[model samples]
Target: MTKSQIGLRERKKAATREALSWAALRLAVERGLENVRVEDIAAAAGVSPRTYNNYFSSKAEAIVSRHCDRIRLVGEALRERPPAEPLWEALTRATLAPFDGAAEQPDPRWTAAVRLLLREPALQAELARAGADAEAGLAAAVAARTGADPGGLHPRLVAAGVLAALRAASDVWLRADPPVPLQPLLAEALRQLAAGLPEPSSS
Candidate 1:
């Protein structure tokens, strides 16, 4: 195929995927997340059920598709940071980097969809799975940058902690009434992560 043909094909595929994702999220918000069926979502996207399956294995997966790119984006951002930067600093920047280009004005509808994902049991599980993958990717990148073993304990532990901070901050942000900007929330999470989750309690 010609270069233009390839570009067109790629763009078409991306558009189709976005359509499916938007359709699924819309249905999930309109109805309950559990109430939406793959067929119904596909119909909403003007695609066949088979096509929906081709893009995503389950309804929860479809609903959270937009966030998947954010995971990889975080990983890539961390990888590109200056070598002298500490892990927490790099993680803070990487984690919130995706929202830099997003509209400063909060999209109420989109926030509602995020709230739905956080509350829905199945979608929460899917989100956790995505989070786990992101943690692993970040760990691998960190290990490579530091010349440490990717599969070793330190990287794994740090990755888990960082991912946990991210999850906790996101949960808080999702429910924030009048919703604060995500960047500050994420930075606070990193600060908490840096201070350590463990502390000496007043006896």
Candidate 2:
């Protein structure tokens, strides 16, 4: 196949995946995650149930994939950062870049879906699976920058640490009573990670 044909195929797949994710999240929000069926999501996305199954294993996976997709973008952003930039700085910027302008104008429906996911055990499990996939991609990106083997411990550890920090920061942000901005929480999390996670002294 031609390069253009490959590109078109990739774009079509991305569109289909995105449609499924949006439909899943919207339906989950409207009818609760437990009540949203795979067939329902496929119908909402204008795809057959088999097509939906090709993209996701379950309704929870489809809904959680929206956030997982952004995590993958973070890996891409890290790869695109200037090579001369410090790894931590590049990571910090890349990690938070996707969330820029989103905190200020939060989408109510998205927020609702997130809250639902946080509360649902099945969705959390799907999110964990998604995170593992994101971590592997991020490890490859980090390896590319550091000239380490993608499967080596150094790249994998760094990727895992960065993702863990982001997860912790997200939990804190989500639990905040007034709903703190995610970017700052994420930035601080990365900063602390970069700073060697110094222990705080008792006052």
Output the number of the TM-score-best candidate: 2
Kindly list the per-residue Cα lDDT of model 2 for residues 107-203, writing each as its tens digit: 5556655776668898888778879988999999999999999889999998999899889987777666656788888899999989999887688
Clashes of each: 0, 0
What tens-digit string does per-residue lDDT give for candidate 1 at 1-203? 99999999999988888789889888888887778899999999999999888889888888887777676677788889999998778878877887675445466677777685668788889888888888889889878777889999877887787777766776766767776676677788778778875565689
**Candidate 2 has which clashing residue pairs, if any?**
none
List per-candidate RMSD values in Å. 3.6, 3.0
Error of 2 at 20 (Å): 1.4
- lDDT, candidate 1, at 148: 88
Lowest-sum lDDT 10-residue window in model 1: 99-108
- The list of candidate 1 runs beyond 4 A from truth reads 2-8, 101-117, 195-203
Each candidate's lDDT (Cα)?
A: 0.79, 0.86
Residue 154 in candidate 1, Cα distance off native in Å: 2.1
Error of 1 at 23 (Å): 2.2
